[model samples]
Target chain A: MYPTDCRYTREHEWVRIEDDTCVLGITDFAQNQLGEVVFVETPEVGHVFDAGDEIGTIESVKAVAEVYTPVAGEIVEVNENLKDDPQSVNEDPHGDGWLVKIKYSSSSAFAELMDAAAYEEYTKEGK
Target chain B: MVDFAGWEMPVQYAGVIDEHRAVRSAAGLFDVSHMGQIRVAGAGAQDFVQRLTPNDVAKLAPGRIHLSAFLTPEGTYIDDLLVCKTSPEELLLVVNASNAANDFAWAAAQPHPGLAVEDVSERWALIAIQGPKAAAIVAKLTATDLGTIRNYGFATGQVAGKPAILSRTGYTGEDGFELFVEPADAGAVWDALLDAGAPMGLVPAGLGARDTLRLEAAMPLYGQEIDRETTPWEAGLDWVIKLDKGDFIGRDALVASRARPLTRKLIGYEVVGRGIARHGHKFVSGGREVGVVTSGTFSPTFEKALGMGYVETALAVPGTALEIDVRGRAIPARVVPLPFYKRPR
Candidate 1:
């Protein structure tokens, strides 16, 4: 189950707004589907990105997936702890596994995302 | 259902990784009923098997099993199978799931009479319980002393109150057993094992984990590593061939094969890049493609990508620089020795 307070992208990434900065990470469902995250490539701090841009990579025991930015912003910081412990995503995807914290240039980009209920319905149809 | 060697089978029950960890740390159950089972029974059963396989089956004592291969006239491999000498006049052969029909047709075509060959794959079910704790969990439900059965040995026992053939062999390279039971009793045995092992962290594994485990053990997959074009010598399986044994299929070719060194050899590789090298991927060396990846996967034990591929004899040395083409991108890799991970004693 995912937290209801966050917004989700169609790719299953969740973004939680905290103050002026927003935290981004994969959803619990995404981590489970990937299976045993072995390597995580975190974006560098101070990197600027827009919506739907390729940000980083996540490799599991079977395959690798590219993480994309859901909203346009500047990357203020990356989860440096993931360099030594990528399995943190498998353990806690929402908190310890957060990939990046982006300082948004405009808050309106978050409004374009789906709410928890809509994301659930969307994931059901994709399945 | 997932497409595995042209058969639609479940890749996992709960998930692949969870099932994999269960097998490594505790116990895991696998439904390998899709594998082919054949019965060869007649007065000349022993002679017939000896003529077909590369191993010295005539020396196998009753209640013992030997890993052997069916080869073509040119000494290329047809399939790697387990030959079980159930009795003096009866033998049971277990083959890969996808090669059932093909192997049956090939065996029937052999010029041997008075031999009754029957495909009994549908009548039986195969289950594998593998892990370090497999014996303890299984012993609680069976009367047989599992500790007495050595590797590659078998016994007739009652499992979940049903008669079954228990063999001390597995693909995971763990101390475990494979159970062959009647179709009606398959579900009972599965449920019983799960119940008995739940407290021990038993899980129902699937084909995905099976592939990784076998790769880590450096076991060659039939279609991938040893195919129609690959001879036993090239695949580093010369130990299975018995030159002193009497005449057999491809014996002449195998004898001659020993005289000449293999031009190409199967070697292991560990990818050192951001991409995975999958099967059919090309291995580039010296600005040209030199070999093809047979079986590749991200190893759970080593936490790295590894695979087996055919490389030229000169480049088969360990630490040789190689590149694997993954989705049109060249990823840096190096030739490493086989058995990427070994269990600690």
Candidate 2:
């Protein structure tokens, strides 16, 4: 089950808006599909990005997948803990595994993103 | 799960790191049924097998196993396999799944009078139980004396009430057994092994962990480390080739080429920097491409990046520094000795 407080992207990333700031991380399904999280390349804070921009990478023992930004914003903070213990993403993908936090202009812009029920079905289709 | 050589196999069950740790610390069971088995038996079986592989086949007495390679006529690898001499008149060849059909065809094509080569893959299934606790976990299941089966020794017996050929061999660089049983009994044996090993902390591992575990043990993979284009000398597998084995395929060329200086050499390495070097990554020396990585991964045991690569022989020394081009960025690494993680023996 996915958290209903956040909106999900087709890429399997989850984003939750609190006031003008949004916290971003990959969904549990994405982490499960990747097998094991070995390395996460953290993006530089204060970097401006548009939606769908290739921010960084997450690597398992056998694969390398690109992490894409779900919305346009300037990065505010990143989970520095990932550099030392990337397996935390597999251990706690939703809570302590949050990848980045970004300051955006409006929370209303994320209304178009898929809700939990829709994202759950999307993952079932294996898209 | 993904399609691997016509078989749908799980890349990882729980996870690669978890499975890898399971094998290292306690125990892990791997369904290696995808591997193919070919039987060679007849009056001339011993001589036929001796000519087919580079290892000293005659030295492999009954109930013994040895690693060997089926080479192209040009001294490159056709496939790497394990040769088990079940008896004086019988031998079994275990080969990679993707190369099974081709290897079977190649072996059958060779002229060896009085010998019969049969593909017995479908009739048998293999399960590898590996780690330090693997022996005890398996010892609880069968009546056979596992203690007497030295490394590479085997015996035919009943495992979980099913007929099996239990061999003391494994790919995880641990002390363990590879159980060869009938396909009809595979499901039951797998279930029984897991249930028996559960109390001892045994988990079912997958191919992802298999690759990483073998890499840490400094084992050569087929397509990556040694292929049709790479010779035994270049891959650092000259030990497996016995020149005195007498008139084997590729022996002439391999012997003649022994005096030639090696252009590139395979060496193990540790990623001292911040990146995991996966397969096919370029090995750079002085900003120029000189070699390539055969296998690379984030080691669960060492908790650092490790890989095997073929670089210029001059740069293959233990302390030589090199760069692996990871995603267009150069990450520094050093050529360490082989077997990055060894068991605490």
Which of the numbered candidates is closest to the native, going by highest DockQ? 2
Residue range with the least summed lDDT across 10 consecutive positions in model 1 chain A: A57-66
Clashes of each: 0, 0
Docking class of 1: acceptable
TM-score of each: 0.85, 0.95
Please list all clashing residue pairs in model 1, or write none if there are none.
none
Q: What would you estimate as the lDDT of candidate 2?
A: 0.90
Best by TM-score: 2
Q: Kindly list the per-residue Cα lDDT of model 2 for residues B196-292, writing each as its tens digit.
A: 9999999999999899899989988899999999999999898899998798988888987797999999999888789899889999988899799
lDDT of 1 at B134: 92
Model 2 misplaced regions, further than 4 Å: A104-112
TM-score of chain B of each: 0.96, 0.99
Chain A TM-score of each model, in the order shown?
Answer: 0.94, 0.95
Question: What's candidate 1's i-RMS value?
Answer: 2.6
lDDT of 2 by residue, A1-127 (tens): 8999999988888898878789999889999888788899878999989888988889988898888887888899999999988988888888899899989855665887999999999999978
